[model samples]
Target: MKNLHTRRHLLKTMGSGILACGLSGRSWGQSAESGVYGKRAAEVMAHTHENFWLKKRDLYKGAIDKDDPDFIWGGGVMFSAVVAATRHDPKYKSIMRKYFEGMEVYWDTKVKIPGYEPSPTAGGGNDKYYDDNAWMVIMFLEAYEMSGESRYLKRATEVLEFVMSGWDEVGGGGIWWHEKHTGDSKNTCVNAPAAVGCFRLSKFCEPKEAPKYIADGGKIVKWTTKTLRGGNSLFGDAINVVTGQVNGGQLTYNSAMMLRAYTCLYSLTGEDIYLDEAKKMGVAAKAFTDSKTGQYRDSIKWSHLMVEADLELYRWTKEDYLLKRAKTDCDFHYEAWKKEPAKDLITNGGLARQLWLMADMETAAGRDFWKKSDKLRR
Candidate 1:
């Protein structure tokens, strides 16, 4: 019994040591390559570029389709443009134009109100996902910043007006996750981006009203802290007042979204609470990553969520560790797909994700491995 107790104590100590190491930033992977930062940036751009083409062909019928909410297609465009800006690639500009064209159609057809419909046939086409629109607006605004286009900014403002329409009295003040009949479900995924959108939008709008955006963002952050906590950490999902629970499972994407929101809030207000939450979410996300293999598991789909988290952490903290892990995880997933052809592994989305990671890795490491079709490029 004494020996067993001793073993348990030793294991506990080692575990604590590992956790401390992770928090202290010593355990985060560091690349030894020169020009790693630039290489990873370029690699990420290339990957996004490839994914844009693949997703366009397979997911959206060769162009930004108008059958669905503009936000969905807008997200792909936004993500692609972000990569393009980072890498200074011109192809992304063309992709952004396609996305903008789709949004123009959506703006023309969508009811000029504060809500959106997920689909045309569902719920009288009067519903909207708050975060979806919020993220779309953010993407558009960023695109404007990158390209200096006034149309993008105007469209983004219009979307923001729609997003604010969903704000109601619920769990303090948070944007409803959805706006159809199920507008009561206020998940972190929806609210976080809403808060971020409000804060970011204020920067381009009137300064007098900027306080309102800041206040709204603060309220959402507070509500998230009060309602989204399970034990001492953020809940993987939440129960909506109208729809009960939309997402019961922990998703790496959701977590990263939350991180993005928190970081935006921190940047806007210079608040410590937002910064603290970002760090906590960042660390919690680290657990989803395989330390031995450096692959991030998709907590919801069993697919790798490394790319999402990598981009989130990179943008949030500008830390090299997150980028390194992203590269390693991409390499692992690519190799796995090569060895066994799973359905998910063979999809355009999967390949695009892999290529994006590889490109980002190369950009950061300043190494060109696209020519070599080995484990790195598999």
Candidate 2:
């Protein structure tokens, strides 16, 4: 009993020291490859790996207690971050590959239509969420783009098929959030990302098939904008599939995905209207930035995608203020983390999204991967 107690205490100590251990390596002021953002991103990632990663399960637990595995939604977000980190350092490539292998646990093969489930199948649940699978499609495509791995692309395509299965004429053509259709609402969360995923998949498809993806993406974009867009370019949360009543609450990532969709559509079609829409949304999204602190108003998961959309817009518009806003938010958050770590932010999934966003800021500021003049790869 004493030995067991000691082991438990040791594990607790390790979890508690995560932030300190992660931040101990370098001076807060110093910059490294890809500048300060890159350095700090590495630190936070290390903490995530050490404290939350469950090597035995080859998956991340939600928290340091080793209880529940991360929700597949959060896992997908984290996977994208891991893929992004590989751009700054090749060392992350091995970690990214292994993590992707682990993520397959969420893949449900027993169903007539295979898609990623919200929880690990080994734990015996079978329900799938369209939004969760949509996120997987995006993350898998990103992994494929980075590593040129055909398997990643293949998996992304498979998940995208599942996402499309959720689409129906109910309430004028949008993807349902759940496979079981548990909710009456079809969310912007699923539809917008599904559109972005279609645009992304189009790049790798054959000429005959590629246009279909683009057309589908366009249809989704049009439906979502008409159905969800509110004042100030803010998108509402969801719309009831049966009643057609709109859920008026606006969220940052909803607008973020729509902004990315517009940017991607502009890249594909070279339409000034798409660019104009992206700019309008980008301008309106400035409300999410705190006036005094300059920090993002949303939680880390939602706000990171907003910053990513900002960077995508900046790439096209060559707007310096977009970069400045991203830098200010990232810098402030990094310092804030160091000064007084947000205890609530220490979860495996949350840190993963936060790390992904910080690495994107590194890419924006470091300018190592692509330049403002480079064509946006949709």
Candidate 3:
């Protein structure tokens, strides 16, 4: 009887705290009416940005290798710049410049396989992964747009060519996942990034300059949609080449990639279907969240899908609910990190991703900070 009374008292105290924070049921409604959601969302994004820069600077010292998927570091840089641009940050441009410079050495290097040992001894080996090349091109194109640098654009164009070389009709006409090790198997992961690459490429490539690429991008988008839809409408992380059986388990990371691809396609074509698909994916991805901790598992049940999806969602939609959820998730992870900051599985990469998300979110919200920095840049 005493324990039950204690539990009730604790519940009452917690409920009172919620009320005090102005986060109680009625307060949430009033806050939304007064645009509190937007304000809070921005705050969350700003917090994310500060944390990301601090962590990334500590982790990386030199240029990341282009050949290894694990070493594909340009995406974070590009994402950071995007958030910076959204907030109008000046430092973002400098960070972007550094990232571009680090990646510039591999601009002319031949495309490498997606998952192969990086050779320090050999100069150019042929283990080209389509997704890696596609993402790299996407990053370069975004950087070019942010900086108006012809060099970034030029590098993006070159990378696009390399990415296109892997295009072959497999799994009913879509981009192959990998080049060196290829069969009929296809994955949305590869196709989505390729679609983004093509969308970005269209911006710089003229009808006369690279008509084939423009056409190829359209075909790839069509193929990706058809393949993804034919199987489940919701994409699988990967597919078996010979059997054509899709691995239907949903992953938060790839879903965001697909959402971005669809959104980009919508941006290019003004198609309602693409936009609708993006919104649908956004809604579906919400299921990835853990209500108690607010963190997203890497994959739904089996795969340890990390915080990457949370970052992607925050990037895709500036929705307050998503931002709040991301904040809670980041808080949960950070608290966990405090306990064990260096545990390989839970710490290094996971913590890095969590911090990146936090930084990205904060950067998204730091509009005033960005304006001040932009003024300094001028």
Candidate 4:
């Protein structure tokens, strides 16, 4: 009776605390105003915070301990999930701002061109991955769009500038995967999202600045297409700078980012070529979907990006099939997650990402997530 009373008291205080924070009961997945996806998103958000977030550090631990803070890459995905949740429940915006402040631990200040390193500053840091920073730029921009926060936009631009520093004549003009040039290869993972970042920046910059970003983004698209594209218009992993050898291993996210890049270009340039290529790539992405399960073939890290791509495509073409495919895959994944949830950093990040994607599906309402929005203002 004592333990049960304690548990009941804990639940009561938690509910009161949520109410004090201006969140509706539905925001806790208790009611259905936001729909099933929104409810699940709220549940996963709570789970992630309860399991991973460290209030003292203001950042997330990789799992349940203080010893292993999550890497910046996974943290960036988690950041994205927080941003997505804010779209539906504006009460989450405060938590998003707190996370933004906490993420500074990964910002590498030792280098001339500072960017986010893999590890935190206290451990003396590690290699600065362009792909990791590129993901940050994308998510930071999302936060900026939703909150209209100048700080988020400024940080996005700064990180993107660091990523741009990775680009050179290497691998015939593409961004290297990491600052150390470990593999000496330019990857679709980095370049594709970098291109998307550039195109996205074009939207927010001054008219004079917009042209440069678009032109630069176009150059990246041109090089990436000519160099790394493989059979059926799908993108391969990476290309060695010295040997000109292509790593033919394909991941869904590579194609997914490239697909978004193409679509963004189409939106900006209104070019039929970019639109045509985007449609082709969207169709090709189906190859990554499982025939039996209808879910994406890869883990949450890779698959959620494709879900983002499909949703973006659906926004443009009004294609029911595109939306349907994304919804089905996410629905299946959500059910699976309920039975056996992920416990680690990256998988938990992936869990948050899919819930984020589901929240996007719920609140999209014809608004383009990539663009700046006044609608998301609290």
- Candidate 2 residue-wise lDDT, 210-269, digit = tens: 756766777788788888888778799999877778997888889989998887777765
Global lDDT of each candidate: 0.52, 0.72, 0.49, 0.76
Candidate 3 stretches with Cα past 4 Å from truth are 1-70, 73-95, 104-121, 182-184, 207-214, 229-233, 299-320, 338-378
| Cα error, candidate 1, residue 365 (Å) | 15
TM-score of 1: 0.67
Query: Any runs in candidate 2 off by more than 4 Å, and if so which?
Result: 1-34, 122-126, 340-378
Cα lDDT for residue 252, candidate 4: 86
lDDT of 2 at 129: 87
lDDT of 1 by residue, 1-378 (tens): 453343234333323222232322431224334344344444444543443434433223222223223235334433543433433456667666765564333332435573333322322355457766776776666566557778877877777787778777754556676766274477766666666666666666654556566566656656665566444344456656654454456656566666766666555444465566677776676666766775676621323333654554554455666666666665665456457433321232344443444444435321222112111100
Model number with the top TM-score: 4
Clashes per model (N, Cα, C within 3 A)? 24, 0, 17, 0
Scored by lDDT, model 3 comes in at 0.49
Ranking by lDDT: 4, 2, 1, 3
Report the poorest 10 consecutive residues by lDDT, candidate 4.
21-30
**For model 1, how big is the CA root-mean-square deviation?**
12.5
